[model samples]
Target: MSIQVAVNGYGTIGKRVADAVALQPDMELIGVGKTRPNHEAELAIENGYPLYAAIEDRIDLFDEAGLELAGTVEEMVEAADIVVDACPSGIGADNKSLYEAHDTPALYQGGEDADLVDVSFNARGNFDEATGADHVRVVSCNTTGLSRLLAPLQEEYGVEKARVTLVRRGGDPAQTGRGPINDILPNPVSLPSHHGPDVNTIFPDLAIDTLGLKVPATLMHTHSVNVTLESTPDADAVRELLDEQTRTFLIPEGAGIDGAGALKEFAMDRGRPRADIWENCIWSESVSVEGSDLYLFQAIHQESDVVPENVDAIRAVLGTADAAESIERTNGTMEIGF
Candidate 1:
């Protein structure tokens, strides 16, 4: 029997998770919960996904929109084996009670506080940490990218310390309300952004510091990564190692993929769904080692990177598969590699 999955929140991440879950051979997308009957809800229905009214009062609104809901969100949760809470920011924390009421495990996004769950998950960094947990949070986009890159480094050549400068997209392409429409600002303007501590949630002992900048573009997030390794390895070796990682897509030299815009274009040309690039696009030429210091530039597609992680977290919470098996299946099922 397939694992029955329910997605609560049919927005950016939620919709993507639902689509991914639908593609998983061992998982069944029971239904998706939506608070509004906006375009996404319509898209869900058009895609043949069963939609549920997330807010009881909003059922009338959905009806007004000429949309049919299978049931209430509570009813969907009750029937689900696992729920992916992709609600915005603090909303997931608020929905915890509902999931708990039915003894259904939930996976939350990074927007919530660290204490919201005992585990902040990245399939590459800490899939085992989420095994059988009641609530698991897939870390945020930048954190997810960092974790994916750092995991292999931490394993192959012990990371003495990691420092990253995140050139973040001010908003997702569809988030027209979000801004800095013409300016770049130091988001938080503080040293060691929350990402370092967030990373600690996964690799507790690893030392990492992150800085953030919000740029005007909505294409993707670019990371200027510097890590001090315990041992020195040539760039080629590091490239070869990262190349082996299923989720990290190393951009080869002279691929004409100069930046995020071109990368998005490349993804579109490859016929990627929603122009999503789930892998961390590392500049293969940027993989450099100066003695024990290594530096690289990588672009992260914030919108889709965590889609696979959420899928893996479902299996982890159920203890259904080990990290390797689950990751391989997810990558294969989703066609994750470049």
Candidate 2:
């Protein structure tokens, strides 16, 4: 049976989720819910997705913008077998009850509080844990990158502890309304900047602490990560292990890669738009290891990194199929977490 999926808030993440859903053989893109008639609304309609207005008052805007309205958000929720709450952070929190009211399973983005879901998910790390979960939140882009990096170490070498300093993109460049543009802002000067606890939402027993700062970049967020494993592993060996993982790739030093733009350009140069989904762009030259302390820099594509996770989350909640099966179908065609 094809799972009927509805994406709410047709913005960056929502639009990507809708696109991913359309390509899935076992999933049907029922429609999308959005408040305004923006470019996303136009794109959704152009792609033949039925468009539903989230705000009742703006229902006429669809016609004004030359797009057809499928129905209201409530109607979309009632019809869909699964609802992806891709609304902005706080908005998803407010709409939790709506999904429950329709007796439909829901997938939430990382922005929501972890308490809202039965499980928090990172495709590589917590995918097994995501099985049978009713509501799941895909971890934030930063957390997702960190989890993918740590999972291999924890499984192979046994991590003792980890510390990460995040240099976050202020916000999407398009989201220019945000930030101290020319300044470096200490997001959370404290030792653990909600990220460690955010990670705990997925791995309750993980031993990790994180610090973060906001920078003036718009493309991607970078992490300066250090992990103290129970046993030492050579840097080259570590790189080899990481390269073996589908979601990671060691950025070659000779590539002249410096920032998110370089990584995106690298992917585009090879005809990839999302640039191999889980390949979160690890810097080859930046990898370092001293004794048990392993350090590296990884770029997290804030807009695109988490898209596949949403797709996997839908499959997890619906349980109509296994993740591996869904991933196999999406491979090469859709870029299954790189």
Candidate 3:
């Protein structure tokens, strides 16, 4: 059975999710819903996606802009087996009633409060947690990256404690409205930024603390991760374990990929659509183990890392496939590993 999927919000995350869903053999792209007749809306139509006006009042605006329409957001949601709410943070919460009214299952992004969803999902960490769930949040890019990394470690060696320092990008390349364009500022200046807590939504008992900062770069978010394991494994052993995971790309010394800029260039060099890097780019040279603790540096593509997780979450929520099969299918369809 091909699962019908509707993506509401045709922006950064939504656009990518729509394309990824279209790539899945077991899924059908029902359409996408947008608030206005922007370039993304035009792209949706050009790509042959049925474009639905997100707001009834905005239908005239789309007509005025000379863009074709597929009707209203309500029609799209009611027709789909599930809806992925890729709307801006907090906006998904406001639109929850629409999905609920249509009796459609919905997957929201990480910007939402934990209380808003039945479960917080990371395909590697807790794909089963989202199984049969009516509402699941795919988690933030940083949390998704952390979850993907820690899940393997915890499973292989048993994580005792984890600490991460996040150097986050201020905005995406197109997001000129965001600030700190010339400065690196402590984002919250508080102990344990929300990322650690967000991860707990997946691993309820894992001891992890996070610190965050905002940087001038927009290419990706970098993480300085320190994980204390119960068993002492050498750096090489850990590297082997990480490389075995499909969602992780360990940057080899020969790749000469020093940072997120080079990483994005490498994706473009490989002809990745939108230059999207869905895997966590872990610097192989940065992996080190001292005593029972492991340290590494990884860059998370904020715009794209969460894209595949959203696809896997679809099958998880619909109970269509197990984690391994779903991850492999999603990876194969999108070619996730480096």
- Quote each prediction's TM-score: 0.99, 0.95, 0.99
Error of 2 at 245 (Å): 0.9
lDDT tens digits by residue: candidate 3, 1-338: 79999999999999999999999999999999999999999999999999999989989999999999989999999999999999999999999888889899999999998899999999999998898888899999999999999999999999999999999999999999887877989988988799999999999999999999999999999999999999999999999999999999999978889999899999999999999999999999999999998999999999999999999999999999999999999999998887
Model 1: how far is 30 from its true place, Å?
0.7
Give residue 295's error in model 2 in angstroms: 0.7
RMSD of each: 0.8, 1.7, 0.8
The top-ranked prediction according to lDDT is 3
Report the C-alpha displacement of residue 146, candidate 2, in angstroms. Answer: 1.0
Clashing pairs in 1: none
Off by over 4 Å in 2: 274-278, 336-338
Output the worst ten-in-a-row residue range by lDDT, candidate 1.
Answer: 179-188
Tens digits of lDDT, candidate 2, 1-338: 68899999889899888888888888899999999998888888888989999989898877888888989999999999989989999899888888889987788898888888889987777776677676889988888888778888889898899898999999886897888678888888767798899877766777998989998888788899899889988888888888877777788878788888887777777776544344667887888889889999998888877877788777777665575765566554475432
Q: Which is superior by TM-score, 1 or 2?
A: 1
Name the weakest run of 10 consecutive residues (lDDT summed) in model 3. Answer: 179-188
- The per-residue C-alpha lDDT of model 2 at residue 220 equals 85
Q: What is the lDDT of residue 30 in candidate 2?
A: 94
* lDDT (tens digit, per residue) of candidate 1 on 137-189: 99998899999999999999999999999999999988899988788899879
